[model samples]
Target: MSVTSAATGSGPSRWRAGLGRLAAGAALITAVASLPWLSGNDPALTVLRARSADQDPTPEQLTAVREQLGLDEGPFAHLAHWLGGLPRGDAGTSWVSGDAVLPQVTGAFAVSLTLMLGALAVTVAVAALACVRTLYLGSRRRLQRGRGAIGVAVLAALPKFLLASLLATVYGVWLGWLPSSGWQGPASMVLPSLALGVPSGAVIGGLLQQSLPAAFNEPWARTWHAYGFARGRVARHALRRALAGVLPQLLPTVVGLVGGAVAVEKIFNVPGLGRLALDAAIAQDLPPLQTATLSLILLGVAAGLLIQALRRALLGPALRDGALPALHAPAAARGRFTRWVVAVCALALLAVITAGLLRDPLHVDTAARLLPPSAAHPLGTDALGRDLLARLGHGASRTVALALVVTAVCALTGLLLGMTAQIGAGLTEVVSTMPAVLAGLLTTAVTGPSAWGAALAVCLVGWTPYAAQAAALLEQERASGHMLASLSFGAGPGYLLRHHLLPAVLPGVLRNALLRLPTTVLVLASLGFLGLGEQPPTAEWGRLLSENQPYVELAPWTVLGPACALVLLSVLALNGADAVAVRRRPASARTRPWSRGTGLRVKSGVSAG
Candidate 1:
């Protein structure tokens, strides 16, 4: 066998190995499916509570409901019966409504599928246009590139919920160009579609901006020009060659789109699968939850399979031609200057957030309307005469707190759930398996779009990536001869985690936490923007945008201030993390500071060579 084939354990062997892993995942999901029975709370009781018109369920009523539910048959027997029926298209009924799970799921799926399709279309259209614009108009033009960067950064950093609200506010409420939030009319789809598609569009656009430009700059481009080909013709040919290369990189964004749909549907009141799942979860309706869970699994698996197929086809061309150079080295750090810029931005963010907390953000001054920066209001006054400075401060506090809370939740959850075996992995898969946008939607369903809901949602969605890192480190450490001997001698999870795992895992865990903060902040601001966060009369960065958007023509500063602050904080968080990570990199490892698994090489709690 060729060395490459041998190294890969290629073809049939690889397939069999992958099948084994797939089966293992299926088995794990099946086991987790049984968790409904394991919970101490009775499904019958929950049903009775949901259905009962009375304030409370009597013991007699509970007993009768249990009898009807066949709960007396023992949990294991009930589970077995439920499992048996699953194959025949019978997923039981809603614990509260007596509706069959299959029908409800099907109905919800139709709506969600439509929305997903629309979102996919929007993503493709926008991304293609963005690519065309960048490739044709912006590649050789620094001004165009810089302008595109600003828009992409803004889109990328804004919270989904916030973006939804802005779309609604301007197009729906202000100009009446479209419906803001609903699924009732065709107009309604525009806002949510844009909201869901824009983020992914930004990602694909950025990748294209990188890939196409690099491809055009290749040595052969000079040869093509030497042969007297037009610049446009050369660019067109280069783009065609680069398409396969960019699509493979875009697969992750496609998958990310699925996750993002969950949140967008909720915000826009689209009666999709995510909304249905959220409803089922809130009602503790197990059948719908099970069906939804399974469907999501299938969706995720399908996306993965699609990506694999695409990669198998197109990846070869890109690989053989070395088309991933732009992908790998698009923006290498510029050394010390980059670090200094990031540090300054971070310090500025800290100062702004801290200063915002010292005063009451809600204190409004009607007399100060449209006031510019003065002795009293550093950020000036809005049309409402609300102190932008105070609001920005309080908003800063809330935004900072939101990020901190999310980071903590993700760190703890990842460490606890992902680092352990079956139980941990299953739990991790279940929670971290949720995309950020979906998590936010589910949180809103549970927490009712309040600030608390946004926080909890961020906490739920942010943890798994880091957790998987910890788990991988644990497995790697355990495989060492000494550790293997210790494990065989009965060293437990706690000992393994503390003695072997921590040294290698701690730095990465900390770095992931820092890296995730900016994302958490974006989500928080988005929730607020959607009106699911803190309600009006409260100053928030996103809320500031929503409030000041109406006065954009009259007093541009109102919209400009909040928008600037939001962008500033996001930029600072990202750069600060990069700078700090750079400061800690070992001499032997000259890779990007933010790259995943870099911390996996930590030696004695420090990044290793």
Candidate 2:
């Protein structure tokens, strides 16, 4: 096909995709904007309580407030009115403050955008460093690679809230090196930015670390080296190729960083969009919450579009050649050391669960309250004199079980949707933009706060990533030579799918789920910390952290036990993922079409294809 003709032919498809995204965004905005109606909360009463908590408004007062806020209209009419005003820069007036929602949302979004940008910069720097180290330093030793993978896993597994808390405690409270709370200046930005950025950086960096090595070993890279290309030049070129493989993940990671900023913003008291959304949800401030949700959706769409453009630009010639390198799991050695580490983490987790099951977590002794660790109470006592050890142990079951259930459901749902291509890309993008915390808030508004509600909230958006991954993997698999040959041989769809697609896609999807297990656990813990999960007097890890956080200084053990348990759980999940990835590596390496020994061979007078 001629270049101009091909471009013309692709125009309609591109336009259709853009329209689809726009429609998806509009639908998502409308759904989220309907939360006020869905929750069955009286807007006037909510606004009244938020505005003047001490005053008891009479029926006349309620009617007056409703009329003033235009709440007399039906939900659909109200939505139409809000949507109508949005384009003109009016986002309706906040029920609580009686101010325009646009300004409030924009101001908060600007703060959030700044934070997100700073965090993105951090992520890029980390990824670049990892790529450079892997490419130039030739750190291909299995032991070094395994250690690097493990370190990244640990860092990636740290929950935003826990990391924020630790940063505040050590840097802000203890060392006094940086301001812990508020957004005063660059100094204040350090802690929150690091808290938000580091885990994401670890994730992005790990992906680059894995990809760069594979790229370096590609036939093109080796051929370039043989042609007497400078080592640095070859490595730099390889970096670009490796990055193309990692670009698909960049959108989700970027969106996730913004979504995750909710907890970090709450912990650090940053006046960002996330914090605003959380506060509005808690107060049933629909106008502001709706605006925030809409803003987040738009951001996700924009990021996705931008990342797509960048990928195209990066793979300019390669796009035509269809020579993009596939990303593989890092080839970390599954040595005794790795096994030992995994074993220890597993044993510790098992012990915690078993010990917790046998203990009385609910037993509280006021007389023994705030006691330090001893033989009687090994993990010390909380303010209510509940044994920390007992609580940690018992909470393990609730937290771990719930996390497992959520992860399993998400993985299964994602796998089915992704494999079947049941979910549209636009819809997946829209749903992925909604943070777990925001989803939990919406669920809480509808069902009230409960563990079930929290789990439901997570399930709502948790499947998007897995679905996206699986769909992408399936698409790649279908485009492979073997699948094409099977189709050419008159193999039926059922046969090809049963004998080829399922076997090829299942392992990767499962591995993606295992990697996501820690994140699921963290999300549930975050909801509990925010009171959207298990109610008070219930032993849950997140609830424990929240309950004991205030008394952390006075009785460090109260918080330490649960905190350590969470960290340990994250480590275990990551190690398990590593093991799974490594186990599948050898098979993938042997089957991979483009290896170092057999590089792409461009024919004369034709393109790189």
Q: Pick the candidate with the highest lDDT.
A: 2
lDDT of 1 by residue, 454-500 (tens): 77866765665565455544443443334434344465666555555
Give TM per candidate. Answer: 0.64, 0.87
Clashes of 2: 1
In terms of lDDT, the poorest run of 10 residues in model 1 is 323-332
Model 2 has an lDDT value of: 0.71
- What are the RMSDs of all candidates, in order? 9.6, 5.2
Candidate 2: tens digits of C-alpha lDDT, residues 360-433: 98898999999998988888899999888888888777787888899899888877866644235556677778
In terms of TM-score, the best-performing candidate is: 2
TM-score, model 2 to reference: 0.87
The 0-to-1 C-alpha lDDT of every candidate, in the order given, reads 0.58, 0.71
lDDT of 1 at 11: 66
